[model samples]
Target: MNIHVSYPSRLYSDKLSLDCGSTRICHDISVAIPDRGFTVIIGPNGCGKSTLLRGLSRLVRPSAGKVHLDGKVISDYSTREVAQRLGLLPQSAQAPEGIRVGELVSRGRFPYRRAFSTWSDEDERAVLAALQATSTLELIDREVDTLSGGQRQRVWIALALAQETPVLLLDEPTTFLDIAHQIELLNLLRNLKETGNRTLVAVLHDLNHACRYADHLIAMRDGRILFEGSPAEIITPSNIEALFGLRCVVISDPVSGTPLVVPR
Candidate 1:
């Protein structure tokens, strides 16, 4: 759908905190993400990066404070209504066994469909576009269970892309890939950013990849934001130490010219 949509403004959390059962994963945190850029969330393990992303996507309800999507309270939106505007690829997603790639991708059209309605021409076009965008068109007939780790990951991304949401959230998308596949996936996401007015928020484990691919970076520590800005402004030895408790040297990436970090 080529709708004339305004790029969503920065998502804001007003003193957001999350309680998973009894444990507090994220504390009172407030931050505004940019509207039309790739924003990566980084920190040491258990620093609440994924939790924060979940809160932003409204997948996990917050214990305190509120999350605002374009000034509207996120909790106020219906599930399908929210899905129409924001898509999320969680850290680990399980596809039904033996499902074909095309079928799986077509499921992304659910939010855009009326209850009990069949797929439409627009849905087919979207599924096709997503498969093409992720370079998975050739695998459409293949069973998702038979694909390699990288290919499966791409298929998952294609599903999200098929949703055609303005805001995309990914949680550690490169987790199972080798170095080359990791770079490939990051490059694909960068290309998607260039192709439209999309807002990407990814929880990334690799500090270097986050710095190189993200237009903006949010460094979290102990459930609070340690820093947020362009890579040049947020990535530094001191910032690294504060976020990950590591001493690292930050340099410029020869290819992307963004920050490149190496641990001591």
Candidate 2:
């Protein structure tokens, strides 16, 4: 898979600082999300990967510095404008009780419709495509609350896909998924990246999966990015030990030829 790439994209940050309530999470972090590549943020617990994702997506305003999209400050844009350009799947996403899957997914079209605007064929197509992309089309009419954890996760991803933004930010999307579903989701993300028109950024805890699927890997520790590069260039045993305090052996994955980490 030709994963490593940096073409062009609007999503980038300059010395972005973030706060979780009164506590500061990250400081002076800068990242340029590739125009058509997969960027994964990896770190130990409490290292602020999720907070960085939120900052990039504008779910939370940067405490300092700026997040820029297409050379403009992201915060300066209207909420609708932001939604049109960026889609976000937060880790704690929840659905309203009794909300059907179709209804929830349709909410992604909110930015495209006005108060009196009717649901157009374009909207329907996007929703259906998103559902199919996530393999959730069969459950389109099901209640969101009734699905299993992995199914619900897929549905949430479908909602983000329905947004149809060129830039998508996800926070631990594999959470609540079993091993098989996790691989399935990562493969789906890889398929999305094949379009060469979308920027996919995610925070993932699975080091080996990150290596396999990420075009660019960012390692964070104590609220700072320790190092970043292609997985093969950065996923060394020394880097693994520094990032997670684990002694590990790094080798090539038999399937993808990407780096694979095994703790000693």
Candidate 3:
């Protein structure tokens, strides 16, 4: 299979450690996200995958080490500055009561708008483009609380896309979706990579899906990276068994010709 290489992007972590209360999730892990590509993190439950993602997105402060964006420490930038550069669509995001789809998406422009400055045409275009891209334009007038799980996910993605950040991070974006919706979301994510200027990272539980959609696959276990490389190189049966403790056969996907993992 053919794979493309890209430069490292804004997000990177060195010796990163994260804690949940007194328990540490990960320790001394390092990562560099390639610029403008799709990178997926996969691992078993309770393996600190989500915690690692949280650290990268600045939702969880590192107990040790550091996360950097654009070769600078992330903490040096103000919250708004970080927001302008990195966008995160957290798992199971909730919308406010009575908030319309358009209203929820419009919030993405908050970092760009000053307290005294009114919303501009550019903001409107961004929101509209985001809605259209996610196929949520028809739902613009609908209340977010009334949408289905799949529909809500699309809307949330649109909200993130409206942020127009260079790096976007998602945590299990397919968690609650049915098979069709899961495929829909993955295809949408693949299309986002076509721009070749936006970086995408996601934590996924499905090894097959990760192999299919990821340009770079990170297999983590016990808060450490067991393997990191192109899916073609990283999705071996040995890596799959190590990551999930599952004996599996790795084959070429009939559709995409990417690595396909089938558990025995």
Candidate 4:
């Protein structure tokens, strides 16, 4: 494996803490998600993996410290300004009743629109390109509520891509997906990163998938980050145990040649 030295980081945390109501879900987590890379955060349920991701996305306010975007504190930016630089795909998207795919995707252009402004040609082109990229162009006229799980997910990704941000974050994008859809989504994300369209950060539950696709990996447990590095450096048996509390043997995946964890 080549040492994947990161580009200058644009999104990072400085001793950030996240809260769910009055209960703290994450402790002080100072971490950097490398720019223009595919980074996967993995840990057991309730370990604050998604909480940390939400903080980075500014979907949740940091209870302590800060998240930085482009070397500036993210909170300093206006909501629309932040939306122009970053996009987020939550675990499950709730589309309006009977909303068509195209209409839902067009919402991504909200950051660029002025009050009562007409949708620009650039917005049209972006929405079209995003639909094509996700292979959902044919579904543009279809209602979002009428699509299958896989199809809906692709449409949701198209919506995010339409935003045209330099950074994108996903919270367990594969949740409730079958194996085939999960692979499809991961492959799409990898392609997004490889094409230099955006920096990718995802919270994932599957350790093997994280190892297979991540250029960098973060492991968390008990509301704190425990380890972070390239998968080859961080997916050792001991680290696996520390993060997931399972004894496992780590081996090279025959297909991708990334680390594969086999629990004993």
lDDT leader: 4
Off by over 4 Å in 4: 1-8
lDDT of 1 by residue, 1-264 (tens): 111123446577878899888999888887777887899999989889999999999988999988888669998889898898889999778999999999999998889998788879999999999999999999999999999999999999999999999999999999989999999999999999989678899998898888888988988887778778888997988888877788989988999888898899
Task: In model 1, state the lDDT of residue 27.
Answer: 83
Assess each prediction's global lDDT (C-alpha) against the native. Answer: 0.88, 0.89, 0.89, 0.90
Q: Deviation in angstroms for 155 in model 3?
A: 0.4
Please give the lDDT score at residue 87 for candidate 3. Answer: 91
Model 2 clashing residue pairs (backbone): none
In candidate 4, where is summed lDDT lowest over 10 consecutive residues? 1-10
Over 135-227, each residue of candidate 4 has an lDDT whose tens digit, in order, gives 899999999999999999999999999999999999888888899999999998898899855899999989999999999998888888888
Give one digit per residue, the lDDT tens place, for model 3 in 17-131. 9999999898778888877889999889999989998999899999998999987899899999999999998875778999999999999999999989998999999999999
lDDT of 1: 0.88
Off by over 4 Å in 1: 1-10
Q: How many residue pairs clash in each candidate?
A: 0, 0, 0, 0
Off by over 4 Å in 2: 1-9
Model 4 pairs whose backbones collide: none
